[model samples]
Target chain A: MKLDRRKFLNMLLGIGGIGGIVSIIYPIVSFLNPPKSAEPKVNSLKAGLNSDFPENTSKILKFGRKPVILIKTGKDQYKALSASCTHLDCIVQYKQDTKQIWCACHNGLYDLNGRNVSGPPPKPLEEYDVKLIKEEIVVTKLG
Target chain B: MKKISNKLINWIDERYDLTPVRNLLQHKKVPMHRHSVWYYMGGVTLFLFMVQLFTGILLLLYYRPGEDSAFESVRFIVTEVKFGWLIRNVHSWSANLLVFFAFIHMFSVFFSKAYEKPRELTWVTGFIILVFTLAFGFSGYLLPWNELAFFATKVGTDIVGVLPLVGEPLKVLLRGGEDVTGATLSRFFGIHVAILPAIFSFFLALHLIFIQRQGMHEPEKFKNLPEEKKKYIPFFPDFALKDLLLWVVVFNILIFLALYFPWELGNKADAFAPAPKGIRPEWYFMFMFQSLKFLPPHLWFIEGELFGVIAFGLIGLVWMLIPYIKIKNRQNWKYQPLTILGVVAVVFIFIMTILGYIL
Candidate 1:
């Protein structure tokens, strides 16, 4: 029944362990019933200025909840395609070297026009309408 | 306080019968040798796992599981919530460390032939737990809903899609549809927090119970040494204290990592966004990821990816059945092909992971 040094230390360790466990569980219980958050929603977006995208380069711009890749093929010519690849929905890129929309995964290839050209992609990238209003480039969803 | 506690302990022991447990600890001994360091690996791995469980629970508090909110919620946690960044980083780093030491422990057991005797089920349970730990990493990676995580997960699932007959269905089931979507987020969340933890806990208990029942395996050389010359320490205080010391050292290292190298949050995932350059899996999975990249687009009649998946599956099977294989070959005991294979596998993993970073 005596309070030995070893017994006291064990009691201290047990208390610390309980404290540690409580600290962990508190956050999780709070998270499970989180307060509602206000989220911004958008349908159409002005990606950037026309000069932001140079010739033969690709720019990824957010439209609504997803991203659209705007490719400036030449001076005054631009094409917009949904960035999500058709194969597995990876964001596709404009490869300046290959002059094609390239997927690093599986080497899936799509032409500038969003048509599936090669590899495992079963469908083409979704085409989007691009308009240059004044100097700003705006991207909108296609029907 | 001492008298009250003693009485309470006595009351509980009268019902629960703590005598055998106390006696077992009193009698237990761990052999002391040059290779005694390997014995600590299991305890260290378990300590890291306990850390993971704590940090993971903290993370679950703030991680919103959905395509729309997943990324935002994670960002909010890291950038806004109090100590959220530390919790997340510790959780991630500890997950990596768990896998790291688990691999070391498994290899140590293999080399020591600790999996040879009645301890075969112990090895099996340990291996299953390792697999679940990797699965934990895979599922948790996507919870952040970052750009790299999204694409990497897509690629990972596509690898699963290469299985022969059940491939397509399994892929769909994992992704919760044709692709990684909102459904995929929900599925991964469920698996990471609920399913994987449950499976891991069950197997981990079995592994530990088996170890406790069988005791630490002495190497062949140690078994032949004269009993008078051998050294041992009681498991309760001596060995347990050493294990605690190692756990403390590991905790210090983990804190330093969590503070100095806070886990990076890449750009938010834009499902419609173009894939970024240099995307890769977590370092642990890099070996398999890099190996799959080396495969040709087509191998004979079957697709190259399918071939790679099948090869990896076969390798895993061989690894799981090593105890049986060794026992069957106990008669001849000529060349240790399994040991050689283990070394080769370790070398391959290192090379592939290094190459994954470089190429």
Candidate 2:
């Protein structure tokens, strides 16, 4: 191929422009992808003393950006699950009457084991491991 | 002083070959007609955006973004910093006015049929800019980290999650996780100040270049008039001065609003708290929010909110491509289909917006 001075310069400018644009875009794309810290690695949180948590009662505790529900199903038996509804991120409340998690925003229901039972929730609420260590209740996120 | 200024201009003109620019400014003309007032709408919007940039920067000097400090910083800004309340108020008021003027500018363009043929790209670019302006408002609304803003953001992002495939991921990306948190606040802060401004400026530059190249759109009546009968004024001194006068008038109104109705920094956001009653989106988004609220839970096979969203998307796509949609005047009707459609849209928006507030 016969390459003229104008054509060569044009090719160089085109490559230079592409290179410049890529250089600017690469950092931005990576920067916008949230860092690991953005989703805090909060694996376990103390949910107060097990003695204080009465039987058949639940309390919502802060777990990073989400809320985790700790339910005292029976004496020395506890369950922990994500409080955010899978449907729309509305915080779910533990219903003592139905013995299930309920989202008031859409009336979605989840079983005590975090299974989606009814009403628009496409997925189940996330389950967390509950442990009692030295009389203190601890909620650890499940993988 | 005039002699020195003329010499400086001549020196630069000789080196840079500024004749094209000089001719552009000197020879450009604005067509004068009944709809000439609408021409000032875009300029007013631009002026208000400038005000937003100014006051936003001033607020940023004291504003901090975090779950812990966002509300506190805003409180400090209004209560501690000198004239901070005024700056914050001006910023909030100017942001609303900018959106208001942009809507007027868009409607004026539509009714005047200014988006026809060669100006199609202008209309498209303007539409994109308006979208980004709303994004600006949405992102900025969360920066205060108040209860209203917190729940509003949640509800807004929830609506985004209602879409099918891309919706969930987009919602996660916007929120920076599974939920709206300090991470979301930081993300919105970056978007409101840096990302949005950079993108908005690029489109704005293109929009302005297109307008400058095309001059102002002449109404059909003005276009049909004979050259001898048609009226026009020089764009540089005559029309430009009028635009500046309007900007001055608008600036006074902005000051009046800021002084009389200061923007409030409500209660701080509490993640565990149940969403407060009567949670609503901003005024510009109220029409859509209200319409979505009116939808039944299930519309046929699809969820009602999802259906509403999809409908809005399709309608917006058609509206953006209005100039390209060719409809044959089969009946030779006096009123064009597009014009009638525009009127219907205006009426719908007005009624929906009012209902959004009152109901």
Candidate 3:
């Protein structure tokens, strides 16, 4: 094929235009994605002392941007799970009467094991690891 | 210098045909009439919006959006940064003036019946732009995180919550959660800086393209005149120079207002504090805000606020579709219904706005 002067110039212009567009878009796309500093990777948070959370009671504490419910099932036994309901993101509460997690927004229910058992919740609640370190209850998010 | 410029122009003209562009610039004409003054309104609005874009970006350099830092960052800008106060004030004043001139441009088009027939899409696009401009004001208001802005946003979103089925979810989505918090500020910041500007630029481009394609809307009286009797000036230099002169005047006014009465940061928002007395939305929104205030708590079977919202939505829909509305005119009729409706709308808005400030 013959590469005429006009055709060569046109190809160059097209390549230059694409290069210009990419250069403009690269920074914008990168800037829009929040930097690592803005969203700290908080894997573990010291919730509170075990005594403050009595047995059969649950307390919602801020785990980064999300709320984690820490429930004391029994003496020296604790369970931690994400408080955001799978249905609509309303903070789920521990229903002592039913011994289950309940979303008040839509009556979505989850068992003590964080399994979605009933209502509109399509998935189970995420469970976290609970450890007692020097009388402080620490909740660590599991992968 | 002239020879160099001419040579450069010829160099580009050789590579690409510039006839269409040259013809568009040199041959385009703007109608001359008493109402020609209104033509400058749109240009002034566009210029002010450019000012907003420039100043908004400058302020963004120092403005951080978060519950803890939003107010403090703004305070730092005005107090510490060099000429930051001037940039902030220009942004605020120019935003208000942009909305004000947009309203004038819209009303001028309406009174002149320029929205009829071929220019319907132009009107629609222009209407959408006005709506987006108001949304810009509403979203940008909360970025400062001041007491007035926070409370105003709360009230604004609460009004959105009063709608029927979608209201609750929409309000939640807008607030990012149940109530106004740091999350809400982040959402508004993204919307004000990114999403709205993207969509607004698309519609603005379409609006300007349509106007360029069809040229300016000549008044009916001017259109009816003989071709020799009608007067027009070339848009390239004559009309454009006048537009530039008006922009300079408007810019001076904006600077005067910004310098004389600089925008205040007010107190940092305390969510728990009882909202301060006389919490009001911005002046552009006062008409609807005050009208909603005058509504009774309940109107018969339905809630008054809900009724007002629905009524406003329907009225806005009708106004947007006015160009498509066909009203047969009986000969010898005293007044046009649409014209009367426009006048009534103007008067009602003016009265409600005044009452908003006073009562």
Candidate 4:
């Protein structure tokens, strides 16, 4: 059957509208459908020197793409805690005087060992295996 | 003989007295009110939306929203990818500006009574578009996996939990769990980058179509009403074209601001950070957040959170329902409480926003 002019135009407009919506939605759906966990390159992230980390202070160290907070307890001993807030994942700040990693965004506080102390933090800071290697602080991320 | 007929057909088509086309092509009249410059706020909003679309696409090239790759991908985009920081900033800053000017545009139209009579539907549709615009902001907040976005989403979605019966379910659906997690980020990403824009564009197109069909509203000013109002431009070649020119100017301003005061990317969200006191939202939202702060726990036998949910939901419903409110008697505008309340609400929001920043 031959389509009338108005009908054809309406059909085209309908097609365009549906197409626009689909075009907008398809990528977002794919993106939303559980992103493949980036192949973890997390093979023993290396951080800073144990002796260089000041007492009572936790330094934000880069271990690959992860944040490892390195705090000095003794001359050769260092503590490694993840700097991610357990609430909404805001960057947790390390206050030297308090000996705690704090998330200022939502009032989440964690002990130097990454245990949640108070406020809205639902989880403790994840700890990493930390050691001193020839004056360099080594951090291997643990659960 | 066929060639001759074809030439005749072409000639007739060309000379079909296409005066309608010629008139549209010619430059037409535009409103020359001194306050017409304020009209650029709407144009600014439109321009920023274009910027958002472009920059969002650029961001899409690298952003990973999920449990594992979210933080890592964000790091790569900011520090590793070439000019990725600029793309991220442009998108971020434009989103802020887009929401800002949309509010300004809505109120400008509201206060001027541009929503009266034939323009009522336009106002209503525009309001829906505004809602979706904010929803866009809310969803996009979690994508960066930073402290502010992370905790802010927690506080935000928790607010949804204050709704009476459906509250918990709403929160769960929004976050995709009992808490903000990889599921939450992915859900928000879907809404931000896809769903909200789809809804907004639909309403926005309808708004424009209504404006074109009914034409811009004439002033109710009896004595001071300008005679040239009736003689103004058509949407196709005149007003819409003017809007384009204004959009170009606004686009340049956005670029300048983006270049000069590039958006600061805060620290990537770490789930273990201590929450900050007086954690606030984007300035436009600060008023409502502040409003919630003002409510007492026992207001009308309910907690402040529940009260806030009902109050805001009511306000939104009234805004959407304003078009159908009939003021019968042929001429006098209805003294609807919603109007005064809307103005008060806008002013209150603005004042509270400033106060939030200060206090």
CA shift of B144, model 1, Å: 0.8
Per-prediction DockQ comes to: 0.17, 0.20, 0.03, 0.14
In candidate 2 chain B, what residue range of length 10 has the lowest lDDT sum? B272-281
lDDT of 2 by residue, B34-151 (tens): 8889999999999999999898888989999999999999999899999999999999999999999999999999999899989999999999999999999999999999988987
- Could you arrange the candidates by lDDT from highest to lowest? 2, 3, 1, 4
Using lDDT as the yardstick, the better of models 3 and 4 is: 3
Query: Which candidate tops TM-score?
Result: 2
- Overlapping backbone residue pairs in candidate 1 total 6
The RMSD of every model to the true structure, in order and in angstroms, is: 12.2, 4.9, 11.4, 9.8
lDDT per residue for candidate 3 within A1-143, as digits (tens), equals: 36688899999999999999999999986655433335457899998787777789888877876778888999979899988765444567888888998865345689999998976565799999999998899999998
* TM-score of structure candidate 3: 0.73
Query: Residue B178 CA error for candidate 4 (Å)?
Result: 0.9
Task: Give the whole-model CA lDDT for all candidates, comma-separated.
Answer: 0.85, 0.88, 0.87, 0.73
Clashing pairs in 1: A31-B61, A84-B272, A91-B274, A91-B275, A92-B274, A92-B275
lDDT of 1 by residue, A1-143 (tens): 46698899999999999999999999975554323333346656887888777899988876655668889988878999988776655778889998999987657789999998887666788898888899898877777
Q: Over the stretch B34-126, how does candidate 4's per-residue lDDT look in tens digits?
A: 445555677678788888989898888888888678777877887999988778777878888889889888877776677877777788888
Task: List ranges where model 4 is wrong by over 4 Å.
Answer: A1-143, B1-30, B222-242, B326-339
> How accurately is candidate 2 docked according to DockQ?
0.20
Tell me the lDDT of model 3 at B31.
93
